[model samples]
Structures are given as structure tokens and as C-alpha cells.
Target: MKLCFQNDNICVYSLKDWVKLRKEYRIIGEYLGSSQATPTLPIKLLPEEAIFLINKNVAKLIQYPKLLVEPTDDCFKEYNKLQVDLQQAEQKIYKEYRKKELKPYIDKIVIAKQRKLNDSVSTSSVLNEELNRMKVTQENIIWPTLTEPLDCVKGESIEVPKSILMKRTTPTKILVFTDLWEKGYYVTCGKKFGGDFLVYAGDPIAFHAIHIIRCIEDPLKPLHTSELVAFGRLGTSVKKKSVLATKTNETVNYITINWLDL
Candidate 1:
């Protein structure tokens, strides 16, 4: 598809292309007006969005978002077959949805965030030990692989390069995000929260974010006290811890600071 980069977000003006982006790659964005008066098509891409497409080879960067396209069947077969059953205890599976989700690590338990629990299945207290360990509370988890519904994945999965993606963002930022994913914690971009990431200890719908982390690539970079003060205040105001993280070879190191009353 062809999306022009504008105002830090990619813009697509064609209906066919827009549908392909939405239905195939599942790039979610805000839709502008199609009225006769406001005959403009604008879809806002959040920071790293266009690049996410680029790194996945889904979209290219001619400046920001200019990619080569290969006509692939948008069929939902491969993604449909992704759910696996444990041989010892076979159970059902589901793909659920929420806005702006990525499968990220394939081996991890896929959690559908910010959406209502599926009516089809309730959380079963007595599940196989392995299933309980994976933390899939219930079924109905649909993939956003191809369509709007959660748990849906692309029929032809996009091969994203970590090196390509990390280049667009800071090492520390990716470090914290990947680390959280690996550690079984949920994280979302904290653009609105005045931080890099909002750290959720558990399912976002069930629990609120416990921390707001700002990433610093260079560990030696001096942090401004005023900046820390502001972040600490904001985190406390929202009842979340304010954290600063730095990237290293081993893992991301985190430091939390609280605002002092004195």
C-alpha cells in the first residue's frame, strides 16, 4: 500500500489501499471525514507506527512510509491455525481484540487488553496446570492478525526485524518494552501519561498500571531533577510509580523515585 508520511503520521487517501491496510496488516488509526465539504483522507499513525510497518516489511520508508508491496492472499488460514492444544489436556482457544495490539512474542500467552470479557467462556478456576501457568483466563481470544476482532493474526505473518525496529526507537525504550513482555508484565505506550510506558502488573482491564517508566539510553546521562519531580508528581497523581530505565547488555535496569513531601 502507499501511505504518505505527514505530520509524524502516515496518511492514506485511497479506499482500496485503506481497506487493505486495515483488513490485511491491521494498522489501526483514527479515520477522518469523507464528507463532500471535507474531502480529505487522513489517518494518524502514532510514533513508531509507520516504522513498525516498515520493519515488518508491511510498508516501506521513502522518508518515513514508502514500502514495496507484494500481492499476497489476505486469507485468514495460517492465523486461524495458530491456536495449539496441549496433548495432555486438550482445550478450546479463541482470538480476542482491543485497539493497537501486537502479537510481539509468539511464545507468550496472548492477553486481550482493555476489552470486556467474552460471554462465551468464564474464567475456570480448575484448569490444567500448564494452561493456568500461561494465564489464559478464558477462551474467545481472537487475533487482530487480519481483521478488527482480537486475537486475529495475518494469514501471511509479517517478519519483523528487531534491529530495524530498534533503530527507529531508543535502545532503552525497546529494552524496557521487550523486557516487560519477557517478564510476563503488560505494557502500553504512555504518550498520554507523560512517560514512555505505563506498566501493568496484570491484565489491564483487571488491574491499573503500577508504574510509568521513562527510558534513557545512556546510563551516564544526567537526569534533570525538575523532570524527575514532574514525572514523580504525575505518577503519584495517577497512583503509579515513576520509573527511569537504562539499557545494558544484560537487561534493562529500573529506578523508581517518589516525590518527597518535605
Candidate 2:
């Protein structure tokens, strides 16, 4: 299978190829459709995703033409414009909320203004300061993405996703991810569930995360009993196993904590 690298993700140009890849290799992404003759299948993938596929030789990278096609001046400019527009819109919303928040003061100010006094000036001053602070935060919030992979980053023979590593994914997390992947488990980020990963025994479409694993470099090390209790409760509530996995010399040990809710 071949994947065209672009927009910090890989694209399988044809729908047929996308279906084949997903059904066979479990490659998942957005099924973006276009109004043109053929629908565009744009798949969003993480840096490790592409790297893992390439490393396993299950898929091929088609990042040719040293100059990337997207993420040009126009793309970034458009994205920034969208961000600004969204910020301004949200600002209007919060401005309404702020008015409601200051309703009592606003009523007092309305009476003061009617009486031709400057008592409301201080309130206006504080409100304006807060609004200005909000505006400042909304400016220059850059979204890190691309329309296609650029030629600047590549290894000796293939494209390397340095951004993923730079994002500081710990070696332990990566090790656990690859280990589960090799064993036919579909692993995804489980930070929301207070675990390193959400492990699915089968395709996510067919099954939910059957286990939530918190990766530990050393299991013998002491951990808070409260943490274990919380993790176990969460897993039990979700009908999944709460596990602590420790790796040693490429071998992982799983210690399952079952909540005996008697």
C-alpha cells in the first residue's frame, strides 16, 4: 500500500485504496468526500502512525517532489484568518456574558449616567481591562498542521516524523504503544481516561477499549494507594481492566487491579 504524505498526514488518493488499507491494515482516518468526480480521502495520522507503518513495511511513503504542495503562505494565512475570525466571534459571545456578569454594576452605572455623574468610570475601566486581556490571549494562536508533508524533514531513505518525537512522547509510552500494536491490539491515547493508553482487543468499530494501562518504568516503585483505587474504580465503571504495565528488556509485565466491589 502507498500513502501520499501531505498536511502532516498521509492521503490515499482513491477511495478503493482507502477501504483496502482500513480493512486490511487497520489504518484509520477521516473519510473526507469532495464535490468533484471522485471524493478526496484525507486521513489524519500522528507522526508515530506514519513511522510505525513505514517501519513495519506494511505501507510505502510517496513523499516525492521535494517542495511540499500545501502549508504554503496562502494556507497559513487562511488558517490564521480563520482563527482570528473565530476569536472575534467568541469575543462577542463573552462580551455578552461579561455584560451579564456586571449586570448589577451596569444597573448602577445606568442610574449614575442618568444623573450625570462619573461614578461608573471605574467599573468601565475594569471591564475594558478584562476585555483587552481576552483580546490579547486570542491573538497569534497558531495551529500546528500542514496541507502536506514538506521535503525539509526526512531520514536517509524515508520521511521521518520528527514533530512527534519533539512533542516529547516518552520512550515508555512509545514502547507500550508498539508492544500492544505488535500483539494485534489497537492502542490509542488514553490520557482522558487517566491512563497512558486505551487498549482495544479488536478494531475500535467492533470493540471498545478493553483495558486502560498506566505505564510505569518500574512496578516495584511505590505508588499512592489512592491512585490505584481511583484507576481501578474508573476501569471497573467502564467495564475494562485497569492495568499497570512495566517493561524490562523489551518484555512487558502486566499487573491487573480488579475492583472487588463487594
Candidate 3:
């Protein structure tokens, strides 16, 4: 037997004995008093309401009188189950609304930023040199090399010298491509599987270089106005900066990558 809070306001009983009340009474309002009665306030009961309340309360007490005496493990378990069920229902409702209402706005902002990047004139160095003070040797940089090269539709690859590779022990490569920027797409690296390498062509090199320098300058505060503007230029809006800022407290160690390795 269980007590259920139904439709946010009414309480329902699920015992064989309690089920007889439904057959004995017609409308809950006739037995319980005004089906529209608010749950928080006191109810003005007629004779029928008083009789129904006394009978139900007495029956519940008789059946589960121990529950009225003290809190029990079974009672706690039931309470926890109800709480979990309520939370699950709420999360489902929120997720549905977020996908339908919020996602389209985010996509629109991203598209607008991409258009801005496409329209702007290219700059050799968008990031200031002072910001690039942190340097790592090729030997120090980490390179996740590719097992097989992806078929390149455009641009030619140049040989990366071993001398450049030996300069830093851990080399991290940022891949940039002109076509992605020209088409108004934000370039993101693929997942770091074993033996994956970075590659970039034309303007993407400049963007990737700026991103690396930014990562070095204040790795924690990676999303500065300049970075936001860069993203905006590429077609993404900056609304999520505040949310990201909250997460920036988590520590991230620097990993260096040489341009040649990509």
C-alpha cells in the first residue's frame, strides 16, 4: 500500500480497503469537499467531507499505525523513491524545452559569428607577441601522430624536418585550414586517438597559433574578449563565456606542439 500525491494537489490511496471508498462515493468533491480546494489552506468541510476524512484517516492509522509512531527504514525508502521519481520527471521536461527553445538561438548566433569572420580581412598575427612569451621545445611537445593520412581535397603537405621535431621534447600541433574559415566554420580538432597528428593550411595556422598563444598566456582565462571576438568573427555568439569562466578554475597543465609535426 502506498500514498500518492496526484496532480500536484490531491492525495490518492492504493490499498484494497481504501479502494472501496471510490465505489462507495461518486465525485471526490462530494466525499472530500470541492475537488478544486487548494491543498495549502484549511478546508470548510460539510458533513460528508468530515465523515470521509475521519474514515480515511482512521483506516490509514489502523493499517500503518507504526508509521505514525516513528520514522522507519521503509518510510525513508518510500520517500527517497518519490523524490527520485519527481526529479526525473522534472529533468525530462527541462531537457525537452532546452532542445526546442534554446538550441536554435545558439545555432543562429554561431552562424552570425562565422559570417563576420568570412567578411573580415585576414591578419598575419591577430594575437599580440607579448602573449606568446611561453615557449616549449619540440622535444617537450606531444604529438599524437596519424596511423594513416586523411585524403586531402586541397593544399599540399610539406616535409617536417627532424631538427625542428628534436628542438622540443613535447610538441603539440594545431591544424589550421583556409577553406574552413572561408566557408564560415569553426575549426575543431578531432578526438585524440592513439597516433593522431595535427595539420593546418593558410589562415587556419594563424588562428591555431593565436589559440595556442592564448592557451599559454593565461591558460585558465582562455576565453578573453579577443578570443570571443575571434569566435564572433567566425559566427559564434559569446553568451556561454560566463558559464565557461566558472569552469576555468580547474587546473590544466601546458602541452606544447611544434608547427612542423602537424
Best by TM-score: 2
Error (Å) of candidate 1 at residue 89 is 46
Tell me, by lDDT, which candidate is best.
Answer: 2
Please, what is the TM-score per model?
0.43, 0.52, 0.23
**Could you give candidate 2's per-residue lDDT for residues 1-262 as a string of tens digits?**
5566644455655556667656776655554434234434455554455556767887666655543544478767876797777667767877778777776676565566646864445656656755566552343432323333333433333444544433555556667777787788877667778887888877777889899989997767899999999999999998999999888877787899999957
lDDT of 1 at 38: 38
The list of candidate 1 runs beyond 4 A from truth reads: 1-164
**Candidate 1 per-residue lDDT over residues 1-262, each given as its tens digit:** 5445434444555566666755565444555434333333456543344554564676653222213343245434543344433311233331222111223432232223113343232223212322444433225332122212123221222333335444557756755765775676766667788987777777565778898988887888787889888998998898889998887785889999887787
Q: What TM-score, to 2 decimals, does candidate 2 have?
A: 0.52
Error of 1 at 256 (Å): 0.4
